[model samples]
Target: MPMEDAGAAKVGPDDLQAMRPHSKPNMPSPFGRLLDRATYWDLMIVASATLLVSSTYFWLAPQSQGALFEGRALTFPEAVYLSIVTFTSLGYGDVLPVGFGRVVAVLDVACGLLLTAVLIGKVASERQASLLLLLHTSDTQRRISAFAKELANIRGALSEKSESEATTKSNRAELYSLRTLTQSISNYMSFNGFQAGIVEFGNFSALSALYDELDLAFEVCSRIVHGSGKNSDAVVMARAVSCCTRIYVLVRLMSRLHRSAATRSSLFGTVLISLRLKKPASLTLAEAAAKNKSELLFQSMAIGLGKAEAWKARGYHSLQLERVLAEMPSGSKDGWGNQVHKLIAAKLGISNSVASKCVATLVELGRLPK
Candidate 1:
């Protein structure tokens, strides 16, 4: 009994396994695979060939075995005419399938219906995709145009030399507007679909123009800080620097996305060059100058605010420290005092003695603090 029990225990799992139905993965058949891989024109050609072959079969079959047109075995032209009428399910009744030809006609009708349905679906999907692309392009154009217009307003405001209370309030408003635009752009680009669409079909000229406008904004802000001498408006300069940093990061992100797309194809590189979307030598030089100016502005703001340590923590490192120091507004009130120099030296990983000497040279060159 014990031996029998052990035998049953071992055999039970095997019996259950044998009784269970095995399932194969639901892979598509060869015809289904062909349908999926074929293009619209390819499918059209296939459908045409299928219709012709069905007609030819009727024409070649024995007089008594195949379809008859007008009470007689089909001629070649009559066979084609019958095939069309049957495939469309028109049932004209002038042509009649006899014997095994009825079965062939039924199969041909099924294939014709399937291919027609597939082609119709393809047409609908293509139209939908094109409509979506058009909508995206229009939306992008509107946003870019609005962004450029806002930047132009800010530039005009900054170009003024007035120092009245009204002007100050206006400047503050413009800065706020800049921040709002930046936020809008950030939110818009955050969507994966939008990012992909832009990378694939974005207007290169509009993007280039937007970038140039942003660079101009940076230039205007830098000019205001440099021109204000030792009494530079700390609040305005700080706000401008914050906004510029965000814009710069966003620009770099867009550039990186486009660059990655370009790397995917040699054709993309050629297209970019032809469209002037790729930066030329002059544009590259302008970009470098803008970067240097931005750095100087950031460093100047940090020194004025006594936030050298905070600036260092933000991962900003000046490559052209000497030129930056030379161009920076000089004076004790702008926080270029001796003690502040030591703080700059410490945060920038420079010795106090060298920083002092550099300051001395600037002062001797008539760039004295007010």
Candidate 2:
């Protein structure tokens, strides 16, 4: 219909119909959340367990009188297969579930219908939003962004599997270790040193949980090197330790470099030892001459920290890095570890501007991420 035609109804772009907001259905139970938080593998195992339990429930459902199909005698796998086919509405007509299981099958079909309707509606809205999004972006970047999003999803899925694999075999500590490093950095950048340490330390305690998490992790590592059966036997743990050693040395060295004389003395020992084990490489000017304890500490941390910069000259995102580092215990004035951040930040290739802002924020109590 032409809008300009006499007596014709007109609809403007703003007056066009709009889709409803997406509804996130199928929220997990509290128990599911508890499992998810504990370990991804825990989630998988629990779900597998639930499938087994539910199969039994479905199996126990009473048979109906004068029924056409009796899937009650089917095996676990067959029942599950039939359940999937029914729920998806594929109904191939090969086999059917009968009796109370038939009731279960009907309920599943209803759930599937509700889910499909919601998903289709949501997809329509998302396509509209995506069109709006693309209006502002070039074709190339949009494609690139979509590709990246897909890649990220794949990586996330793989990471989940890896996390679960770690949990099942007693190598789960590395999950916490990676979590600690990630949390330590993220918490500090988004929160503060004492706050970050406390949060991550709590996570450590929850998993390693010997009343004192940090102390326990340190003890476990010490014991493993010194021959303790209780220590992590899974090689997955070695990666976290190796990563931690590098990060610890990096942070320790930075703290000493950026702290006062007294602080340097405290952190120097930790920095040197980490470097000796990790063998982080040094950089220009930093390697020239580490005259004092602080300088020496900077030299050590700079090695591991420097390698990261070398790899990602501009990709490291130093604005967040300095904020995270500054929020760490090692980055604080009262931090007991030998500290070295100023030159370390510079060596890690953070700009003078970013370094200043991070330090400024650290010395203050404002501008935490939401």
Give all TM-scores, in the order shown.
0.42, 0.21
Query: Which lDDT values do the candidates have, in the order given?
Result: 0.57, 0.38
Where is model 2 poorest over a 10-residue stretch in terms of lDDT? 1-10
Off by over 4 Å in 1: 1-124, 160-164, 190-196, 264-370
Tens-digit lDDT track of model 1 for 301-330: 335323422332222222113423644455
As a TM-score, model 1 comes out at 0.42
Cα lDDT, model 2, residue 137: 36
Worst 10 residues of 1 by lDDT: 4-13
Estimate the lDDT of model 1.
0.57
Scored by TM-score, the top model is 1
Which ranges of candidate 2 are over 4 A from the true structure?
1-56, 63-72, 130-370
Kindly list the per-residue Cα lDDT of model 2 for residues 244-277, writing each as its tens digit: 2433332342233223222221123335545664
